[model samples]
Target: MTQTDWPSKVTARVADALRARRKELGLSAQDVTDACAALGYPIPRTVIANLESGRRASVDVAELLVLAEVLGVPPITMLFPLGTAPTIEVLPGREVSMWDAVAWVTGESREEAMKTPTQTVLNMFREHGILVSVAMLSRELGEEKRREAALARDPEHRAKFLDMVAELDRIHARDIQSLRNWRARMRELEVVPPALPDEFAYLESSETAQ
Candidate 1:
């Protein structure tokens, strides 16, 4: 395909995927039109039919977003059609695996070494969020275990509950330290990390005090 043909090829691929997904969901072209209207985009039934029949050679970005929402699929899925297609012509002459195309489109690198500085920062913040959630869950679990220990009539059961609480405490402390270290790395990158959640507000307060 010529470089100029890539645009039409992409549009045709998306159109075919849209038709397939709509049929799989037992929706007619009119159904899609109504759904788009409900979403405030108001794509006409004739437009949907034209797109599916290849009478239309182009799709607007707004139409693509609305259609994907109406079809209950990610917008990228319509563009890339992974699983159904092994590879996609991401460019005129650059055909790659559907998964690789997806990774490129989403700004995700399969190899950590290939990640850009922005991707690294995004991943660091994502990891930091997970650590925050783990720390919060551990703190809650510890409190629940402590309460169970207090209510236990059997001395052995109470001891076991207390041990679990201790383990949870260790987990929470480890997560907190990991979060602090992540924030430190963000600072080193000259990027201001997001403020910690209330459950971890003490980490910042203590650091300020020191």
Candidate 2:
């Protein structure tokens, strides 16, 4: 559909996301207005209020980018949420939702599907023995991708970005190796503690009774 032909739901979702983030950051309408001014965009407080209330149907790319930067989030995050299931056409006659594909990819191991909030939270708790801030990790990765994309757009910065990415990869590899070694060491040490004296005597008494 053309941009003008887009449904109100589309605009509403964007509005909801922006409003939620603003509230989450404890930013008032005036705060957003002042931030926009500092960024040289100079969006009025009334404009921000209109955007959050869905009175503004469309936001220009430049404004959205500046707003996202000021709000400490990637631009697409304010436009569309990552939690929604994406529609993928696998074949001419077949289609699969992104969520279903993620579930299939994850299998029924320590982790499962990460498509829905409930499933993602459950999997995080299961795999990490607690949540372990997986959501924060996802946000960090998202920001990294955003920065990489921004750097890729600049010919002068691409080489430096490549070197930085290479160093990041090396660090990640070392961290992974260290984690594996730690796990191996933990496995080598017996995890089961010695039985208590009372439990041992109980077992002996049960054996004798038998």
Candidate 3:
């Protein structure tokens, strides 16, 4: 097909996926319309019907977002339908795997050449946030173990609980070190990392003391 025809083909693909998903969920056109209304964006039943039947030539961005929410699928899943369609013409005369299409659209493609410095920094911050969560959880777990050890009546049980607490403390310490290292890298990149939570405030204080 010519480049000019690609837009219509994309609309057709999305239309078919929407029809299949609505049917799979046993929802009628009116049901979708009601859902859109509930979401504060009213899409008429006739509009939904027209889109599904290929009577509508284009899908509005707002309509697509609301419909995807009502259909209980990611917006990208509605457009790509990965499992059902193995590949898509992401561009005119350029067919690629459905997964690649998704990655390109989301700016998360694995190709190094496709990655910009801004994307790299975003990814770094994302990873750092995950490490911070892990460290927070580890610290909380250690606190729980300490409390359990204190409440144990039997000496043997208390000893076992104390051992567990020690292990948890070791884990928390390791996690905290990891967070410190991650923050250091962020600073090296000339990016100011987000402030640590109250529980982790000592990390910053310790650095200041050093």
Candidate 4:
């Protein structure tokens, strides 16, 4: 009996999309290699073929980002099919990023789409509780990988990631409101946002999202 050797879900999804996209464009492995050369990446045809075949087990974030940009596929498509949104298991009583909510919806529908904030402002309501900045958030995400490794070793540790994401998301929501509210508050402070000296003179919300 042959035991199944399963790839990571993300890798499998990416491989499927690569194959589908190549077929849809009627492009061969050599064609992709040539296009990549023109675009200045110049990856070999065998590399393209290997990735498409799921023989490439790992890709760094930068490489994946470049591949998505080159292939005309959104980065998330390589993680999961875009037609249905992934289930967002939100803990009660927390504000999630509007973009993340939209992402979850898009994932459920599995559509290739994105939403971006005009600006995101974050708040840390308590000492030792708030990630101080976006820089801090990035650091926390990095730390979470270490946490994830620990969790992998102990099944009980995994739930912490979900909780951490929820907490971080709340801080991000506060930040979004912070950016929006800054204009009104700046007048009180006798200061103006550098982007616009004449406050409320030029404010246009993203029409694609609320």
Candidate 2 colliding pairs: none
The clash numbers for all candidates, in the given order, read 0, 0, 0, 17
Query: What C-alpha lDDT do the candidate models reach, one value each?
Result: 0.88, 0.58, 0.87, 0.54
Which 10 consecutive positions of candidate 2 have the poorest summed lDDT? Answer: 191-200
Q: Write the per-residue lDDT of candidate 3 for residues 1-210, one digit (tens) a residue.
A: 998788888888778878998999999999989999999999998998888888888887888899899999899987788887788898999999999999987778887877898778778888888999999898888888889889999999999989998998899899989999998888889987888889888888876675
Best by TM-score: 3
Tell me how candidate 2 scores on lDDT. Answer: 0.58
Question: Tens digit of lDDT per residue, candidate 4, span 65-157?
Answer: 666776788876665564545432222333344345445634432224422221112111221123234424544664665566555755556
**Model 2: how far residue 139 lies from native, Å:** 26
CA error at residue 143 for candidate 4, angstroms: 52
lDDT of 2 by residue, 97-199 (tens): 6444344434422333335655544443354322123333433554585488575968757667666656665655554344334333333553222222341
> Model 1, residue 121: displacement in angstroms?
3.1
- Candidate 1's TM-score reads 0.72
- Mark the 10 consecutive residues where model 3 has the least summed lDDT: 201-210
Ranking by lDDT: 1, 3, 2, 4
TM-score of decoy 4: 0.40
Candidate 2's displacement at residue 98, Å, is 6.6
lDDT of 1 by residue, 75-143 (tens): 999899888778889888998889989888777758566588878777788888888888889889999
Model 2 residue 64 distance off true place after TM-score fit, in angstroms: 0.8
Candidate 4 deviant stretches above 4 angstroms: 1-7, 84-210
How many Å off is the CA of 166 in candidate 3? 3.8
